[model samples]
Each structure stands twice: as C-alpha cells, then as structure tokens.
Target: MARLQSSGFFDLGDGRLEYHFVGRQPAAAPTLVLLHEGLGSAMQWGALPETLARTTGCGVLAVSRQGYGASSPVSLPRPADYLEHEARAVLPRILDAAEVGSGVLIGHSDGASIAALALAEGEARLRGGVLIAPHFFVEEVTLSAIRRTRAAYERGLLRTRLGRWHADVEGAFRGWNDAWLDPGRRGWTIEAALTRLTVPVTLIQGTEDAYGTRAQIVAARRSCPPGLLTVRELPNVGHEPHREAFADTVAIIAAFVRRVLEDEGAGEPHRPDGAPMGE
Candidate 1:
C-alpha cells in the first residue's frame, strides 16, 4: 500500500516554500528544522525526519527552498552571495512565517552551508546546527565534481534523477550549478561568519566525499568557538553521512541538540555578549 503524506506551503510573501510539519513535539523540546541539499526537497529527506522525531521527541519541519521541490522558482543566475543572501533574507522569514519559533538546524550539502550562514547571522530560532558535507568555501574538488555532474546532467541522467525530487528541476539545477561555476564565486567563503556564531555545531562529513574535504570541518572548527564545535569523520561513508551512516549520524545529532539545549536551559550564554550573535 502507498502511504500518503500531508504537507503545506509557507507563504513568505516574497516566495511560497513547500514545507511539512510532522513528528513528535514534547513542548519542552525545540523543533528540528531540516534544510535539504542543493537538488533536494522535502521529499528527498525520505524517512529520516520521522525517524529523528520519534527518537528525539522533537518537532520536524522540513523546508523546500525556492526554486527547489514545489516552491516557486527564483531568478536566474543567482548572485555569488546567494547562500548568504538566503541566510540573511529568506531563512529568517521562513522561520517567522512557519512559526518555527526556535529549533536545531539539520542541513545537508548546500543546505548545510545555508544553515551555517543562518547561525552566523544569528537566527534566534536556531539553537544548534548539524552540518553534513557543508562547504564553507569553494574548492577545486567542489568545482570538479560539479562540472562532472554538469556533464552528467547534459547526458540527461542527472536531470532525470533530480526531476523526481524537484518541481522546477531545470531552475533548481541551473540556479545552483551556474552560480558555483562562475569564476567570481570562487572567492566566496562563509568562514568569516563563523566567528560570530557561538552555538554548538556538529560538523560531519565522510572521508569518501568527493565534493569536499575534511578541511571543511577544520575550517569551521578553526572559525567557531572551540568549546562549541564538534567534528566527526565517518569512515567508509560518502557525502551524505546522514543517509550513508544513518544510525551514527542520528545519534550524534540528537546528543548534540540535547546537550546544547540543556546547557542553554541551565543559563549558559549562547553568545559571548550574553546576547544573540550578529548584533
């Protein structure tokens, strides 16, 4: 039998984002807001959300950003700062309109980069972050993989596979692909924002990941408050650690969220100034 899922759109006025609110909510616990990968959507997360919510007793709100999934398409040839722009302009509004209030951010790939940006910019709604295969800065490996994928996209396989998850597949593909391939975007880095973030962050990536190196986590750890950061390298895993090593990934994420929330509840300052970051 086919299972039916219920979902709705968050009308942000500027854009309508496809999202689904499901899983357990203990009231005392914060929600787990999930951001999908570049070509991902609310549907691409598969059963991970349900599994996490059940295990952690946290509410789960999975968002499909504009130009991906069922959400509206964005303007073409995205700015070099689109990820940062998303953090500053779009995510906060989504949090506000979705009534997410506050939550832990669990993001993958491009989504992970966006999560770090949101944390850096100080999303009061974000208590912590779980970044998987996050690219803090562009690298040769990153472009190489993307270029290879672009070739595969031209062969029709990539587009066909991504089409299953995206509503505007071409828009999503071009928006993410073209922006990264732009020469000017090579200098882009969200590392500077890390200095402003004090939240507990778990940076997990597989050693086998072709797109980015462990240096991605190293950069984050170097930039973020040492005491607030955790780095985990999953051996034998690929880019999608959460999916490749589901049990370990979920456990690490749940523990990080719990510990951070407990410390915050016990009155530890989330930021050095005893105020939210990015004032």
Candidate 2:
C-alpha cells in the first residue's frame, strides 16, 4: 500500500491552505481529490484518503479551503455567490497547485456543490465526480437545520466540538452558517449548474439527512443529463454517509472510481485484499 506522501500547508499567494497527500499518482490512474464539507478540513477526512488510495491503487489529495483547518481565515459575511467563486476561481488554482494531471473529485455537502459547479463550468483535469448530500437549491429544511446549528454554536456546544479541528472555529462556522442563512441566499440554487455537466457524476444522499431531503436528488435528476448521472439513496443514514456508513460508502465510491478509470483505459482497480473489483 502507498504511504502518506506529505502533509503541510500550501502557499496560495493570498493565503496558505492545508493539505494531506497520500500515495503517488501512477501514470495510468487518476488522482482522487477530496473536497470536505463546509466545516471540514484535511484532518477531518479521517482514514478515507488512505483507504481510497489502498483500495483503488490511486493517489488521494485532501485539502482544506481557506477559513477552515489550519488555513488562513477569510473575512466574514461571505458573498452569496461564494460557492461559484470557489468553483470557478479558487478550485482551478488549487488543482494547478497540486499539479493534478487527471482527477476525480469526491465532495461532500458544500464541497459537493462546489464540485458540481466546477464540473458544470468545466475543469480539464476532472474526469468525473462523487457528490454526497449536495444541495442544488435552497430549501426550508436546510435553513431550519442551519438555524438549529446556529443555536448550538451560540450555546457553545457546537463551537467546542468544532474547535478540535479548526484553528479559527468561529470563522469556519460563521462563514458557512452565515452564508446559508443570508436572506438574499434564499434563492440560491445550482440546478442550472447541474444541466451543464459533460462528465459522468454519481450523487449519494441519505434519506435521513436533516439538512436536505430527496427534493435535492429530484433536482439533480431533473437537471443533469440522464445518461451522465447516477443516484444512490441510503436508508437509515444521515448527511455524513462517509462517517455514518464508512464501508458501504467506500465500496460505492471505489466502484465508481474504477469505472471512471476503466473508461479512460486506465485499467481495473483492485481491492485492498488484492482481488479485482467486480463490475
């Protein structure tokens, strides 16, 4: 199995971003780029990076965007179009900095929305995407959940927990929470972005997710080209399916990753146990 190649902060000129790279990308295989949730960082990804590298024989790069993890904090009251900005402006720079020749993005929550937007706008190196609990548009459930989270943060419960991972926990929380709760953002939607996807995409969502409902899934199905999209809804699971159902999530992702690589003529992916993955 490939070992951790490096872990440190990458200077983006304006600010440094934290990153953890596992394994080296083989000439034939695409790198798996992990985009964390709103409040997540490289460290928050836990064992997913290493496990993905070992299972798929591919490199994995997990990055923490500005205002999260050990990265430099951003000014509060982020713009409503921040997700679009990240997708079009920030993500390309990150991909360039990482020197990712070819990649598959695996994103969760806010990161998933960014990934979808990036794919829609077009990124040359990106072959496909695995989006977990992505929000295509604003919903009452999403606003209500953020309000409850805001209450928890105000009560110091959420802050204390998130403090363990972020150096500026307040910035991380407020940046995400404030943006979502912005009344102007009530009309926020990436459904138009979904319609522009040229590459294949796999969307994974949990039926029990409090932040979003099946309507999000319905939006994707309605917008994206039917042949290019795949959907998986897990029963009895929540927003963080990777953490809530690790093995199952990994299996599903690995299968899709292999299919993507195979379509690129990169060859089959093997299980950590050394057996070839079934189609």
Candidate 3:
C-alpha cells in the first residue's frame, strides 16, 4: 500500500469543508472512498483504507468531516439537521473536489449512518457501499456505549489518546455525542430515508458489536431493495470490524468490488436497478 497525503477545501452552502485523500490508484481502477466513524478522523482509520485500496487495486479517499481532523471545527451544536447537511451538502463538494468518477463508500459507525443517508439521497456518482457497524435506529447497546465513551472522555484515557489525532477532540465528540444523547433525539431514525437507496450494498457488522444489535442490521437490509443487499456478520468482532477482523473485512470489500465491476462488464459498476455506476 502507498501512503499519499493530500488535502483540499471546498465550499458547501453552509461553509467550507476539508478532506484528506490517502491513496491514488490508476484512473481506470476503482475508487474506495472512506467515511470515518463519529470520533474518527483520516488518521484514525490507521492503515485500513490504504490496505483496502492496495488489495483492491483502487484509489482510497478518506474524509475528515467538517468538525474532525484537519477540517474546521464545529462552532455550534450539531442538530438532527446535520445529517441532512452531510448527505446533501458536504459529500457532493468533497466528491467534486476529488474528481472521483465512481466508487465504493466504506463507512464505519456514524460514518455508516451518513453513508446510508447519502445513498438514500441518491447519487449517480457512487457505485455501491460497505456499511460497517452502522446504526439505523437507537439501541440500548448504543446508548450504553455512548455513555461509557462519554465517561471515558470525561475521566478515562480515551480522551487523551484520541486527542493525539484529532485537533479538535471536543468538537468531534460534541458533534456526535450531544446529538445522540439528547433526550429529544431518541426518535432519530434513518430507515425511511435508507429505503430509497437503489444501489448495491454490502452491510458489515460484528456479532459482538458493543454499540448496536442485530435488529439494526435487519433494519438496514429491510430498507434496501431485494437482491441488492449483502450482509456479513463477523464473529468475535466489535464496533471496528475492519480493525478487529482486518483480513476478513478486506476480503469482503474486495469481493464486493470485484462482483460489481464484473457485473459492469469491464465498464462502470451499476446500481441494483441497472443504473450506470458513477458520480
């Protein structure tokens, strides 16, 4: 895998956003765009994105959402409306600036939710997606994990460790933490929005995920069109399947990309509905 560093700023309707590109593959090769977890950043993905790109012979684009990593920090409270901004505003600008024609989106945790919403919103530019440990609805385990993580951030080692990579660790936590824990946010659900996505999708989750349950996975699959959904449940894995079961996770992504590419007949991959793949 190659290590490449690149950053760009693009203006969304609300404000400017920044993103980081990890690896650039042959133009003819597929592109793998990564959307990090809630408390994650480009650097936090560690080497998974690079390894996946190398294994699949594709480019890797890992973004630092508006308030995380090297991007601008969140100056205000993140509301339920924020996910819409991500689906409609931030993503398009990043894709345009990167000049990514078509690609697979690999999203983890909160990133998974954003990816689902993005697909639900419909983008002609994306081929398909790999959603890992995603949440479509609030679960007890999720609330428990958030509470535990909050405690860790407040008095445990998590904050110190994560702060090493995130320039605005507080902003990162606030954007995700406050929104989910808000009493009024318990009803937040993306199932309705996700059901509209007609793209081929591979949902990856761990049987032992600390933050979500099987029901979340069921909801995600049920939201998709029949025959367009694939689910991989890794045993003894947790929230970060790509890291906990790195080899298996990489293999799954490689297979999905290959399947889509082959179905494209040496051209662009297509959605389950037979729409051309690309942005």
- CA lDDT of each prediction against the hidden true structure: 0.82, 0.88, 0.78
The C-alpha local distance difference test score for the whole of candidate 3 amounts to 0.78
lDDT of 3 by residue, 1-279 (tens): 332346565555565555556544425456788888888887677778767655665678887888887777776588777876787778877777666677778899888888888887778778788899988888877998999999988994988887887778888887888988888878888889877887788999999999999998789767777888899999999889988998899889888987876675546543333444342
Estimate, for each residue in 151-219, the C-alpha lDDT of model 2 and write its tens digit: 999999889999999999989999999899888998888898898999999999999999999999899
In angstroms, give how far residue 2 of model 3 lies from its true place: 19
Lowest summed lDDT across 10 adjacent residues in model 3 is found at: 270-279
Once fitted onto the true fold, the runs of candidate 1 whose alpha carbons sit more than 4 angstroms away are 1-5, 25-28, 266-279
Q: How much lDDT does candidate 2 score?
A: 0.88
Better of 1 and 3 by lDDT: 1
lDDT of 1 by residue, 211-249 (tens): 999779878878997687888899999888888999999
Q: Which structure among the candidates has the greatest TM-score?
A: 2
Considering lDDT, which of the candidate structures 2 and 3 is the better prediction for this target?
A: 2
lDDT of 2 at 48: 94
TM-score of 2: 0.94
